[model samples]
Target chain A: MAQKKNIKNRATSKPSSLVWIMLILLIMGEFFLYAWSRVQCTRMGYEITREENKYKNQMNMRNNLQIELSRLKSPKRISLIAKTRLGLIRPAPKQTVIIR
Target chain B: MKFDNHKQISRRAAIIGIMFAGLFIMIGIRVIFLQTVQGPWLSKKAANQYEKSVIIRGKRGIIFDAAHREMAVSIQATSLAAYPGRIKNKNEAARKLSNILKIRFKNLRRKLETGRSFVWLKRQATPRQVQAVKALNLKGIGFIPEFNRFYPNKTLGAQVLGFSGIDGRGLEGLEFYYNAYLKGSERKIRVLTDALGRQFDTGQTNANGLGGNNIILTIDGNIQYITETALEEAAKKYNAESGIAIVMAPATGAILAMAHYPFFNPNAFNSFSRDRWRNRSITDSFEPGSTMKIFSAAAALDSGICDPNTIFYCENGEYRIGRNIIHDTKPHGWLSVQQIIKVSSNIGTVKVAEKVGGRSLYNLFKKFGFGNKTGVDCPGESTGSLSFYNKWSNIDKGTISFGQGVSVSALQLTSAAAAIANDGILMKPYLVQAITDQNGRLIQNFSPQKIHQVISARTARDLKRIMETVMTEGGTGVLAALEGYTVCGKTGTAQKVSTHGGYSKDKYIASFLGFAPAKKPEIVILVILDEPKKEHYGGIVAGPAFKKIAHQTLQYLNFTPLRQKKHQRVLAENEVSG
Candidate 1:
C-alpha cells in the first residue's frame, strides 16, 4: 500500500512541473517576439526616413532642372541663338504665308 | 544532537526569509517613487532624445506670365552653418571652407573663433560650392535648405516683376505688391528622430498648407521680350536718357507688355541703382505734347462744338495768347479739324481748344483718365497733375490744348487710348490676371472692368477716322503706318520741364501713342523716349519702335493680314470650284 501511494504522488508531481515549464516557455517566447518586432519597426522607420529624404532631394533636383530648361528656352536666348548660330531671321511681312 | 540541528536550520531559514522580504519592500518603494515623482521628468527627457518640435517654412510663391511661363521662381538652395565650439580644427576647417566659399581665410577663421553656439558661414551658396564644401567633410559644418528667388528671364521684365530679399521678402515691383500672398506660411510639427539624431519621416511634412499662392500676370512673355528689345534698340539709337513702352489689349485693358530701358536684371537688382528698380511707366509722368491733340479733338467733337471738317485759322505757325506764343512745327494756313490733327499743328489745335472752351476741355481730359490713377495693379502710380479748368490762364489754355501744360503717365496714356479703340468705353487696367494655390486651384480671377463711356461710339468713330489721317502722307505719324493695316496714331514732342522753372531747350520727350487695324483696333501701344539726343522728333524717334512692336505683336497674336485674308479667300473659292 505504501509503495502504491508513493508512485501516485510522483505521477501527479510530474504533470504539474511539466505544465509550469510549458507556461514559462510560452511567456518567454512572447517576450522575445515583442522585442524583435520593436527592433524591426525602428529599422523600417529609419529606412522610410531615408527614402523620404531621397524623394525630397529628387523633387528639388527636378525643380532646379525645370528652371534651367526655362532659362535655356528663354525667348531672348532662342532668338539670339537663331540669329547668330543658325543664321535665321524673322520673315518679312510679305514673306509670311497664312493658310487660314 | 538532532533537536539542536533542527533548531539551527529553522533559525537560518527565518533570517534568509526576512532578508528577502526587506529587499522586496525596498524595491516596491523605489517603483512607487519613480512612477510618482520622476515619471513626468523622465518622460520629457526621453522624448527629447527621439522627438523634436520644429518649425518648417513653406516655399515662396511663383510668378507666371499669361502663358504660364515662369517669370520668377523659388528654388531649394543650401546654406552653410557652423557650430563654433564643436569644431575641432578651426583653422583647417576655415581654410578649407574659404577656398570653396570664396571667403577670406582670416574672415572665416574669425567667424569660427567666435564662441557662438551657431553661426552662418554662407547663405544661398551655389550648388557647386555646396558640393565642394561637402566633399571637404569638415567637422561642425551643417547645411540647411532655404528658398532663393530666381528670375529665369533675367532682365526681360525686371522692373515689372521686381525681386525678393535674401530673407524671402519681396522688396519691389509686383513682388512687393503681393508679398503677403507670395510669402509662405509656417507650421510647427513634431518629428521623430533616431538615436543618431536623424529625423524620421512622420508623414506630416506635406500636411501643412504652407506654400504661398502663385500669381499669374496678364503679361505675355514673348510680347514683353519684343517690346523690351524694341525699346532698348530705340533708346540706343536715339541716345536717349531713358525710355518706357507699354502694350495693352484695347478691349480688355490687359497690360501685355510694360518695358523700360536701360534694363536691369531683377536677379542682381542690388547691383543696379534704385532708380532702375522703378516701373517708370506707372510712376513717372510727362507732358503728352502733340498726343494730347487727339483728346482735344475728341473733346471738340464730343461737345458738338466742332466737326471733323470745321475750319480753324492756324495764325501762320505762331499765335499769341496773353503774351504766350504757341507755334506749329511749320507754317499752316486755315486747315480743317482733321487737317490740324493730320499735320499735328499746335496753332490749329489751340484754336480748336478755344472753341471747345476751358471747362469742356478739362472735363474731357478728366474723362480721359488724366490727373487720375488708372487703378492699375502696380505700386506707386502717379496721378498726373491736372488743375481745374477754372484755374487756367489764357496762355494755359493755349499750352494745354497743345499738350504742354498737362502731364500724364505712360500707363494712363495707354489706357485712355485703349478707351478710344474699345469704342469709347474705358476699362480698368490690371496686371495680375489670377491668383492660384500651389496645386493650381483658382483662388481669384480678374476680369475686365468698364469704368464708363467717355464718348459716344459715333464720336469715337469720328475720332478714329481723324486719327487715321495722322498715319497717312503729310501726317506727323507717317512712319507709324503698317503694311496692309490701317494705323491711327499721334506723335508727341514736348519740351521737358527744366529745373529752373521753365521748359528746357535741349531736352525733349518724343512719344508715339497709337493702335493698329484702326477700323477695329486690337492693341494700343505707347512709346516714350526721354531726352533723345540723335533725333528729337516724336515721329522719327518713337514711330519706328511703335511699328516694330505692333507688327511683331500682331503677327504673334495670329491676326491675319488683309492681303493674306484675301488670298485665303481666293484659294477657298478655287477649291470650291474644283
Candidate 2:
C-alpha cells in the first residue's frame, strides 16, 4: 500500500508544475500590454492639452481685433468726425433712398 | 533500475525541470521587491500616468457708461487654426481653407506647409466664415471659443472713458483707473477626457474664474450725444482749429459730458495718432479771458468791496493803464456791475478790478479753484497761471480783472462756474461715480463731494443774478437763448498770444460758459472754440453751439419753460371774457 501511494504522488506533480508555468506567462504578457497602453494614453492627454492652450491663445488674439473693428465702426464716433472734419451733414429726406 | 525507468530520468527532463524552477524563483523575488521595496515608487508613477486632469479658463468683464448702458463688453467668438500634423492632404487643405476663409491660397499653403506641427488658419472669423469652413469638415482645421471687448457707444466720451488692453486690462481713461475692480480672479478646473478628444459626461465648475469689475460713470449718454453733435457741427462750420464742450452737474462736480475734438476710438488705439489720444479738457491750458471776470467779480463781491449796483465809467469801451489801452468789442458809457457783465466790457471789468484791488481779486480767483489743480481723475492737469497778488504789478492786476494775464483750462473755468451754481461751494470734479462687482453688487459709490465753500450763498445768488442778465436781451448770450426760455451766460473772446511772435492778429479763442433757465438752473454748459478763423466773436462762434445743446437737453429733460404757466390763467380768463 505504501508503494501505491508513492506512485500516485509522482503522477500528479508534473502536470501541476506545467500548469503554474503557463499561468505565470499569461500574467506577465497582460502586465506588459497594460503598461504600454498607459504610456500611450498619457502622451495623448499631453497632446490634447497643448493643442487646447494653443487654440485659446489664438482665439484671444482674434477677439481683440474684432473689438477694435466694431469700435472703429460705431456710428456715434464716425458721425462726429464726418460732421466736424469733413463738413458732411445728415442726409436730408430727399437724399435718402427707400428701396423695396 | 526500476525507479530510473519509471521516472524517466533523462538529461532533457532534468534540464526542463531546473529552468522552470528558476523562472518561478525570479517571479517570487520580483513580487517581494514590488510589494515591499518599490511599491511606493510604482504607485506614484501609475498615478501620474493615469490620473485625469483638466484646465479652467476665465472670461473677461464688461464696461458701462454712467447710465448703466453698455459701453464695452467681452463677447464670445470662434477662432480657426489648423493641426498640420493631422492633415491628410496639404494641397487640398490649403485650397479648401482659402475658399472658405477668403485667404490667399498661396499664403495658406505656405503657412500650412511650414515645418511647425500647427498653425493659425484665421482669427476672429465671422460667424458666416466659421460656418462655411466647419461645413467643409476639413480634418486638420479646428475652432475654439474666445472673447473680445465691444464698445457699443464708441467715441461718445472717448477721452473720459479711455480704453483697454488685449488681455482685458484697462489701458487708459476710466478703464485704467478702475482696472483692479474690473478684472476678476483666474480659476483652474480638473477634467477627464478620452483619447478621441471627447470630454467626460459631466464636468465640474471652477469657483475662481477670471472676472472683471463693472464701472458706472457720471455721464448721461443722451446729453453727451447731444453736446458732441452740436459741438462737431459748430467746429466744422466755423473752421476752428480745435474745439471742446463740457457739461457738468454743479452740485456734485460730476462731469456729465466732456467731448474733445480730434478724438480717437479707444478700440482701435493702434490705428490712431497720439494727437487723437490727447484729452484736452485736463491736458491743456488757455487764456481764461473775460470768463475770469465772473471770478473777479465774485472776489470783489465776496470782499464787500463792490455791490451789484456799483457804477463805473467805462471810458467808452477803452481804458488805458500804463500805456496799455484795453478795447471792448462794443462800447458802453456808464454801467453797473450787472451791465458790465452783460456787455462783456473789458474796460468795465478793469475798472471793477481797480476798485476791487489786485490782492482781493487774486484771492477771489484762488478761492474759485484757480491757480491750483481741481484734483480731477485725469492724468495731467495744470494749476493754471494766477500770479501771486504781491507778485503782480498794478497794471497786471487790472489786466487780470478783465481776464488777461491769467490762464485756465476749459475744465477749470467750468469748475469755478460750478461753485457759483452750487451756492459758492466748490466740489471736486469726477468722471467715474462708482465701481460695481460682477454679481451687480455695488462695490463702491461716489458721493457728491464739496471740497470748499469759496463764497457765501448771498454772493453766489447775486453772482447768479448778474450772470443771468448776460443771457437775456441785454446780455452777450442773446444768441445762447433757447426759444421761449430765459437763459443765463457769459462770453469770452480771448486774444491768442503767440509764444515767439507776441500776439497774432487773427487768432482768438471764443468761449461761452453758462447755465439754463435764468431763475432756476438745470444744466451748465461750456463751449470753447479755439482759433476760430471764420468767426471771431464768442457770441457768434460759441454761443449758438451752447444754445443748441442746452435747448435739446432741457427739452429732453422736460424742463418747463422759465415763465410759469400764465397760459392756464389766460385760458380761463379768455373763457370768462368771451
Candidate 3:
C-alpha cells in the first residue's frame, strides 16, 4: 500500500500544459515592450532633429524681416516720402508753438 | 598483408595533417601583420574619403546710435550657387537663371559650362532675385546662406560707421578700429559618413566661447541728420570743396554728431571716390588761423601776465618779426586784450604772444592738445604739426601767434574749445558709449573721462566772456550770434597750404568754433568749409552754418530762449488757470 501511494504522488507532480502556455505568453509580452520602446526612441530623435532645424530657419527669417523693417524706417527714406508722397515740409521755428 | 597496408595508410595520413597545420600557421601570421601594421592607416584613409566638415559663421554684431536706432546691421541673405558638373542642359539653366538673377546670359552660361564642380552665380543676391530664382527650381542649383551688412540710413554717418566688405571684414572707420570686438566667432561641424558618403553622425563644436559684441555709439541720429543736412546745404551754397560739422557735448566730451559733406552712401560706397571715404575732421589737419586766438587769450589770462583789460599796440596792422611781416585784415591802434580777440586782430595777437613769451606759448599749445592725437577711438587720426619751442624763431613765434605756422585737426580744435565750455577741464573724446554682448548683456560702459585741466575755472570764465564779445555787433563772428542766446565763438580764415610749401592766395578754409548760451553751456559745434568760392571770411562763410546748427540743435534739445522762458511760464500758468 505504501509503494502504491508514493507512485501516485510522483505521477501527480508533473507541470500542467496551462503553466507552459503562460510562460510563453510572458516572454512574448517582454519582446513586444522592448520593440515598442525602441520605436518610440527612434521616432523622438527624428522629431527633435526636425524641431531644431525649424527653430534655426525661423531665426533666419526673423533676422531678415528685422533688416527690412529697419531699412523702411530709415530717416532718409522717411524724409523723402514725407516730402514727395505726403507733401510735407519742415516747419519754421516761428510756426511751431511749444506747449510748455 | 593486412597489417602492412594499415601502417602505410597511417603514415600518409600523418604527413598530410602536418602540411595542413603548417598552412593554418602561415594564415595566422598574415592576420597578425595586417592587424598590427596596416589597420590604423587603412581605417584613416577610409574616414578621409567619407567624412565632411563645414564652418558655421556666427552673426556679426549690430551698430546702434545713442538713441538705440540701428545705424548698421547684419542681415541673412541667400547666395545662388551651382554644381556645374551636375548641371544638365547648361544653356537652358543659364538662360533661365540669368533672367531671374539679372545677370548676362553669356556670363551665366560660361559659369555653368566650367569644368569645376562648383561655381557662384551671385553672392548676396537681392531678396526679389533670390525669390525669382527659387521659383525656377532648376537642378544642381542651390542657395548658400550668408550675412550681409546693411546701412538703413544710407549716407548718414557713412565715414564714421564705415562699412564692412562682402566677406564681412571691416575695412574702414569704426568698423576697422573695433573689428576685434565687432567680429563674430565661428563654429565647425564634424560629420561621420557611411560608405555611400552620406552623413550618419555629427559633432557640433563652437570655435569661440562668445559671439561678437554690439557697439552703441555716442552719435545721435537726429542730430547727425541735422548736422549733415545743414553742412550739405552750406557746402552747396558756398560752392565749397567740402565741409565738416561736429557737434559735441562739452562737459562729457561725447561727440553727438560728426557730419561730412560729399557724403557717400555706405550701401553703395564703391560708387563714390576713396577721397570721400576719409573722416576729414580727425584725419586732416590745417592751420586754425584766428581760431587759435581764443587759446592765445587763454594762455595770456592763465599766465597771470595779462587780463581782459590788458592793452597792446597793434603797430597799425603791420608788424615785422625778423624778415617776415605780419598783416592784420584791418589796421588797428591800441586795443585791449578783449578787443584783440573781438576783432581777431593779428597784430594784437602777436604783441600779446610776445608778452606771454615763446616757451609759455608752446606750453599753452601743449596743454591745449596741439601737436598730439586727441586719442579719440577713430581711425586715421593725425597728430598735427607744431614745432618745438627751441626751433621757434621770432618769425615762427609771431606767425604761430596769429595761427599760421601751427596746424591742428578740427577734432583737436573742437576738443580744446570744449575744455573752455566745460569749465577748463579737457575730457578725452570718445565715440563709443557702450559695448553689449549678443544677448544684450552690457559688457562695458564708457563714461566721461577727464584727461587734464587746461586752465583755471576763473580763466575759462573770463575767456568765455571775451569769446562772447566775438559774436557781438562789432565783432567778427556776429553772424554766429543767435537772436536771444549768447554765442561764444571764434572765427578762422586760414590760407590753404600749397604743395610747394607756400600758401595759396586763392584758397582758404573758413571755420567757426562756438558754444551757445555762454553762461551755462550745453553743446559746442565746429563748422569748417574748405575753399569757399563765394566767401573767404570765416565769420561770413562758416559762422552762419554754426548759428543754424546751434539754433536747430537748441530747439531740438528744447532749450528755450531767455525771452521764451518767461513767455512759456506765463502760458503754463494760464493753462493751469483755465
Give Cα distance to truth, residue B173, candidate 3, Å: 0.9
> What does candidate 3's lDDT look like per residue over B1-578, in tens digits?
99999999998898888888888888888888778888899878877887777677877889999989889888888888999988889999999988888899999999998898999899999989998888888889878888888888889999999999988888889988888888888777766555654444232523234457899999998889889988988899999999999999999999999999989998888999999998999999989899999998899999999999999999998988887788998999999999999999999999999999999999988998999999999999999999998999888888898789899999999999999999999999999999999887899999999999999999999999999999988999999998757889999999998987889989999999999889989999999999999999999999999988898888888777766676778988999999
For all predicted structures, in order, the TM-scores are 0.95, 0.77, 0.86
TM-score of the A-chain for all models? 0.92, 0.57, 0.75
Q: For each candidate, report its DockQ versus the true two-chain complex.
A: 0.71, 0.09, 0.30
Residue pairs with clashing backbones, model 3: none
**lDDT of candidate 2 over B1-578, digit per residue (tens):** 88778577676788888999899899999999998999999987765554455444455556666667666777767789888888879999899889888999999999888889878878667889999988888897878655555566667788776777655677777667667776656555545555566553232533233567677888877788889888888889998888999998787899888988756777678798777776788878888688878887887788898889899998877778887777887778999998889888888888888888877787778888787999887776778788899988867888888777888878899999888888888999988788777767888898888899999999989999998888777677788877646666889888899877766788999999998765666678899998898888888899999998887777666665533344555777999999
DockQ, computed on Cα atoms, for candidate 2: 0.09
Question: Better model by TM-score, 1 or 2?
Answer: 1
Q: What's the lDDT for residue A84 in model 1?
A: 100
Worst 10 residues of 3 chain A by lDDT: A91-100
